[model samples]
Target chain A: MSEYTATVTVRLKAGVHDPEAETTRRALERLGFDLSALRAADQFELDLDAESAESARERATEMTERLLANPTIHDHDIEVEPR
Target chain B: MSEYTATVTVRLKAGVHDPEAETTRRALERLGFDLSALRAADQFELDLDAESAESARERATEMTERLLANPTIHDHDIEVEPR
Candidate 1:
């Protein structure tokens, strides 16, 4: 069993109400940072047992789709790296 | 100016009070996930302009240290990719 690391990011779909992101954006604005296209996302780091990078990516994808995320209102990106 | 993409992960130092992480972990436990070492983190994606990956990474590191995060209580890892 090789040690593989997976980083998964989950973000609310565009047009979804992201209170956390909004709050952060407003705070930034108050601090004099002006960038309107700000979004909030969640990141997960998983240490998984996998034989190869391909397998790790596939498994991470499955984990996101099956359990870690709500696909209807969220989008995810999975990155796998060897350890 | 190349279109460089950066993903910055900000995590609370271990032993810090992470209310959000705790809440999520409890919810997962209630759903029958028996994992004990669950932590939460934040990810930021930046479109930066630089001549090389090293420069992009350096800029991102500086950004995290200077503005995007509170280094006193948070740790950050920056990843740069081509867009």
Candidate 2:
């Protein structure tokens, strides 16, 4: 098995309520910061020992779909790299 | 002033406690997947109206330093684009 690292990014689906982003925008505007648009996303990095790159990708995708992400309201992208 | 978009990426300091990233890594390992390295980060997209790119960047940087990030425990990179 080889060492691998995975970076996963997760974000709220468009149309979802993003109170934190909204609040930040409003605060900036109040401070005369000329705010226009705002969005928020999360990223995760993982270290893994996998038999192969392809196998790691498959496992990461499955983990994302089943555990790491809320499929009903979030979207995620995964990138795996050999460590 | 012109409309602009700012994409900000925030990440934990190298030694900070990252329970979420750690938990996710463990989950991946439990599933019989090879695990290597893991990191966690956040992304923020902001829209702004500013007299110029330089001014906007300055304001955004200040905002990031004062509110959007905890400088002691997080580091951030910002990208500004015409909207």
My TM-score estimates for the predictions, one after another, are 0.68, 0.81
**What would the per-residue lDDT of candidate 2 be over residues B12-57, giving only the tens digit for each residue?**
9989998988887677678755555667788988777888888778
Candidate 2 residue-wise lDDT, A1-83, digit = tens: 88887777899999999998898878877876666578889887777778898887887888788777999899999888888
What is the Å distance of residue B15 in model 2 from its true position? 0.9
Runs in model 1 lying further than 4 Å from the true structure: B1-7, B14-39, B46-68, B78-83
Give model 1's docking category: acceptable
Error in Å for residue A36 of model 2: 1.5
* Native-structure RMSD, model 1: 4.0
Query: How close is candidate 2 at the interface, in terms of C-alpha RMSD after superposing the true interface residues?
Result: 2.0
Model 2 Cα shift for residue B49 (angstroms): 2.9
